[model samples]
Target: MINYKSTLIPALLIIVAIACNRPKAAPAKGNAVWDSVLQNVQTAPVKEEDASECIKLNGQIQANEDHQAKVYALASGKIKSVNVALGDKVQKNQTLAVLQSMEIAASSNDLVLAESNVAMTKKNLETTKDLYEGNLATSRDYTSAQVDYNKALSELNRAKQVQAITGGRNAVYELKAPLSGYVIERNISGNSQVRQDNSNPLFTVADLSNVWVIANVYESDISRIHNGDAVSVTTLANPNTPLDGKIDKIYNVLDPATRTMKVRISMPNPNNTLMPDMFVTVKVNAQPASSMLTIPSQAIVLDNSKNFVVVKDAKGLHKKEITVIKRVDPKAYIQGLSAGEQVVTNSQVFIYQALSE
Candidate 1:
């Protein structure tokens, strides 16, 4: 109980002092001043886009007339003449070379002889008939002469046809070209054994005025390609110049090995520039269905988890979060940012930092 009154009075006086002269707590980390500064520095407003277009794509160059051929001789005889050389231009029905062999000519001569003999017998039979009517010639004699004449007529007709070319006929022959084109290949030289041997071709010809640009289309895009679709192509050799063409055909079946479909395009190789088996790039333009919202790329700022744009929202000063679809040519095509929203175009990063604090 010693000094109880004294201790109670001192405690009450200390409480009274705290209430009368209380020290103010420190200011919070963020407040109105930071917001005001960000608003002052906000960039100029964003403008709406006026037009849209297709994306530029890549393509390749191709040869139109790269033909592969296999040739065989019709008449078997040692090769006589090979007029066309490899890579020589030839005309349609042009004589490539003349083949010489005793076998072919002999058949024709035999046919001529048979026809002459037939003519002689016909004259003799007429005389025999006249004599038989007079009874001056015996029946057996007349009959024998008639039978011999009939046999002669059949032999003469057979000779004219030249049926036995394999063994009976031997003569020089001429082999003519099937079409007019550049001779890409020739198996026969000055004198090679060309007795109907299929292992060799006399010559291979191709027309190269126009070229085919064959492109390998991935299976995913197979459905999008069709006949007459517009296409653009470029080559690694001459990438600066691009060629225009249309899809001539799209193969129905996909290649199992490459998982690609063959798309054929027809383009002129004027001055004969393009070649076969060259690798190239190809692009087919696909039509779009709807429109997309776009603006100059500088308007958007991305941070942490969300992309933001310093926008003048319902609240006097604030930052807006948006979704960016794609960035093309200093312009950002977006989905979430609506049309007519005023977005800060130039200074998004500084504003974001100011707003954060």
Candidate 2:
């Protein structure tokens, strides 16, 4: 203890050096540090929107059945030639295929026989009329000749009508399109045998000017959807381009295996962008049950099984707890936030964490 003052001086010098070198503690929340962070954050006002819940459902693009035509072979024959292919655009009454059929050949033969019989009967009638005029033939003979000629003429006309109905020329049946459309299916090929009674269509042509979006709604969501409900559709091929339409039909029946009902949305496809069988996503903007408060979904932060929104006031930014009613893209229906209040949408999580800490 003789040199206590001298030793204390050295110890105080070492303590001062250590204190000067120590790192500074972080700035407190709601201070200058947070002010800088808030400058970069983005905010939006809470607004009230109609509480129309969006029901997302899977769908498939289909040809409009109302505008589709199924082409069938007129008679049993071997396909002589296929004039069109699958996905070929055709006009109404355009020849699709040629079939060489025995039925048509038989009709051609019957027509020839009718024509020959008519010529012979006409000659006979002329001869009988001359003989009757010269008093060499009886009136009954003239009448009989006239009657036979008339019968032959009737038979010839019937043969011609049958040929027209059969749609055959020169013993070849020509399959013609009933409507103007793109061929969506082709079941017959060159040299393939077709039966007169075959139930399947030779080709399926559909007008793609309009299309149907068939969406499947689960049983639980059926009550929320109805006919004439507005909807938007997106496809994997062109997701950025959304087509809008209304639900024109709702199938009252449900698929037992899927336990879902189908709703039909009719949309105009002016560009033919929507193709049949293409999978799509459907968003039905169902009728609003009521009105509710909404905010940008990004403003809401989830933490510890609770939702919070960073609300800015005259004082500073504060994390306020909220109850999320539902979350649709870009907007979230929330409670505990009033309309006109500004909430941070960008970098909200970082600010929330800083305030919580």
Candidate 3:
């Protein structure tokens, strides 16, 4: 009763100690001022996308066979001059090489002999006709002259046809391009001997305006890929820029040696950027069997072997555990997230850690 001031002071001190030991309250929901970390966080809405699996396979760039031409010598000859080199662009019917052929020379001689015989027979026929009209020649003689003149004319026409078929002009044969394209192969040079029986082509011209991407798929993947499936192709020369295409052909036959089936994708090469035999990577977007929710790959946070995404809503920021079905670059197909929901993408790990704590 006598020391009232001292008793009150001790009691107040005890109360202040208990308050210091108690836990601090969490910041209010959606209060940016209280949660300074929210100021730097970025968010994106979850999207619903068709679920798909990507099948990566090795591929090659090939010139379209439809627009390619293999030039072969029609006759045996010595190549006098080659007007084109490998990689040179040429036009249709452009002279590629000049060949001096012995066969052509023989044909020319035959043509000359035929023309001379025709001239001689025509003169004889005229004389015989005149004689018959004057009763100095028999009717059989006139008929024989007409037959001889007709035979000579036939021989002359045959000679001309032989020369035309041999492509012989002035005893020389000119090798010309069958189509307008770049000469991709040149096997003959000036003074080289060529034979009609040669199996190898003398020159190969290809139109680079359209090309094909031939990709190989494993045996296990054959059932997954189909015609009309979308694909992305990238070459070593241009890896960053991917070219879009579709699987236009599926070679049903499998390679016995490789145990893989081949698929073909057609692409337009307007600038001639795609070259023949260029190695490439092909990514086939296989058709989806169902739909799933998608989010930015960066939004995912891995902790304790579990994936989580920090979701932001009107109530507050919260960490929700999610299951990842697949991950394509820049996108992660997932479960446990709804479309149109916002999730933190940037600085999400920090936000997730804070939310977990």
Per-model TM against the reference: 0.54, 0.83, 0.77
**Candidate 3 lDDT by residue in tens digits, 1-357:** 234343433433343344356643334655533244444457999999888889899999998999999988878899899999889999999999999988888888999999999999999999999999999999999999999999999999999999877778666998888899999888997888999899999999999999999999999999999999999999999999999999999999999999999999999999999999999999999988688899999999999999999888777677889999889989999999889999998666555544554
Clashing pairs in 2: none
Which 10-residue window in model 3 sums to the lowest lDDT?
Answer: 7-16
* Candidates 1 and 2 compared by lDDT, better number: 2
Quick one: how many clashes does candidate 1 have? 20
Best by TM-score: 2
lDDT of 2 at 259: 99
C-alpha lDDT (0 to 100) for residue 1 of candidate 2: 23
Question: Which stretch of 10 consecutive residues in model 2 shows the poorest summed lDDT?
Answer: 7-16
Best by lDDT: 2
State the C-alpha lDDT per candidate.
0.64, 0.86, 0.86
State model 1's lDDT.
Answer: 0.64
**How well does candidate 1 match the true structure, expressed as C-alpha RMSD?**
17.1
Q: Which regions in candidate 2 have their CA more than 4 angstroms from the true location?
A: 1-30, 121-154
Alpha-carbon error at 137 in model 2, in Å?
7.4
lDDT of 1 by residue, 1-357 (tens): 334344433433443344346642211235333333333444543545533432333334443444434455666667767887876878877877777655566666777778887888888888888898899887886898799799888897677555442332447676666666667667776666667656666766666677677777777776666787777777777766767788898778888998877878888775655655556777665554356677667878878877787766545445667787666557777766677767776445654444443
| Candidate 2 residue-wise lDDT, 255-282, digit = tens | 9999999999988998899999999999
